[model samples]
Target: MNVTLPPTRSLLVAGALGLAVLAAAAGGWYWYDAQQRRVAAAYAEVMTRVYAVQSPQAPADARARAQQELEQILARHPSATPVGEAAFELGNLRYAARQWAPARAAYEIALARAHSPTVRALARTSIGYAWEAERDWGKAIEAYQAVGREVGPKDFLFDEVQFALARVQELGGQPAAAITTYQRLLKDAPNSVRVEEAKQQLMRLGARAQK
Candidate 1:
């Protein structure tokens, strides 16, 4: 006697297969997410330890280890949330090493991709410093101005941007513009620690305040 599976049996088998597939997909996704979290946690811990090392000598090994861990995280998860932070940290390291162009590129990438306003502002400030170090006054001014506008005047980086803008103007042979920017900065940041320095700069430039 020949035996054949009933339609109900076939339907049940297909349903079970579908459920198994779904369960497998969900399990895989959960595992991948867990791995990502572990990588992120490791990166954070390393970064914290690297930052905690106060002595320059102490930071060398810590920085190297942190960088290695961050590199691994970046390799595995290029678009991860911590990737922007890692790029920013690498930019700082490059800047400290006087590798200006790489530092600037890293900072620009971090600034463009950073979701955190604070991180974006810091990346912008770092890019401006890199441009300033290269004596590219135009780029420096643009970077600082972008930071000031994007991060807003109330951001903690406001004073830094203002100072950078003023310095760029001065170095670009735009003394009058520098003076105007400095005066505005002084007015807006009357109690800023850099206010006295701004005044001295204005005096050196022979800029007379408009009464």
Candidate 2:
């Protein structure tokens, strides 16, 4: 009986193929990481410009430049990790300019792009504020209500959303709803920073929280 041996050339080909696959995977990861780093650097640069506009002595063109750069980031890297944050900054610039329609549009983009719950919540709340700025109480209430429904009570922004909802309801000629919302805030977020404010609002509304 003769013993047959497996071909060594076939074994070498298989090993080379495995190494190639691993090299390809590593190259792909390196490319992704490099792209992310570039996105982060761009985001940081835009944020610096954004924050610079907060100074009372900021240059008149500071906000415009910041807004322009942020828009460029959105246009250039629409699917990047920082796209949502850039959109939020753009929304803030528009909001400060009292461009309510444009502000809400930017915030809508933030909401669509952001993966973080906090960012999404902030964008949603800002949308409500933009409506409030426009004196569109009904739409403001709807936006705030959407936040309440989507975010949990344990979320850090939940109390703020509740307060906004209550305030909008009151201004929208729905005192009963406002009172109920205040009571809900009082119940759901007893230790929130807004708790005292909620109590004051309840008092002014001639309502008390249920035990």
Summarize candidate 2's per-residue lDDT along 1-211 as a digit string, tens digits. 9888668998899999999999999999999999899888988887887888967677758887888888887888888888887888899998987899999999999999988878888999999999999999999999999999988778887888888898889889998899899899888778888888888888888844343
Off by over 4 Å in 1: 1-6, 52-69, 207-211
The C-alpha TM-scores of every prediction are: 0.82, 0.78
Candidate 1 accuracy as TM-score: 0.82
lDDT of each: 0.79, 0.88
Question: CA shift at 125, candidate 1, in angstroms?
Answer: 1.2
- Tens-place lDDT digits, model 1, residues 32-103: 999878877877876686466434676576666665665566676677777777778878767876889988
User: Model 2: runs farther than 4 Å from truth?
Assistant: 1-36, 207-211
Q: Which ten residues in a row have the lowest lDDT in candidate 1?
A: 50-59
What lDDT score is found at residue 25 in candidate 1? 100
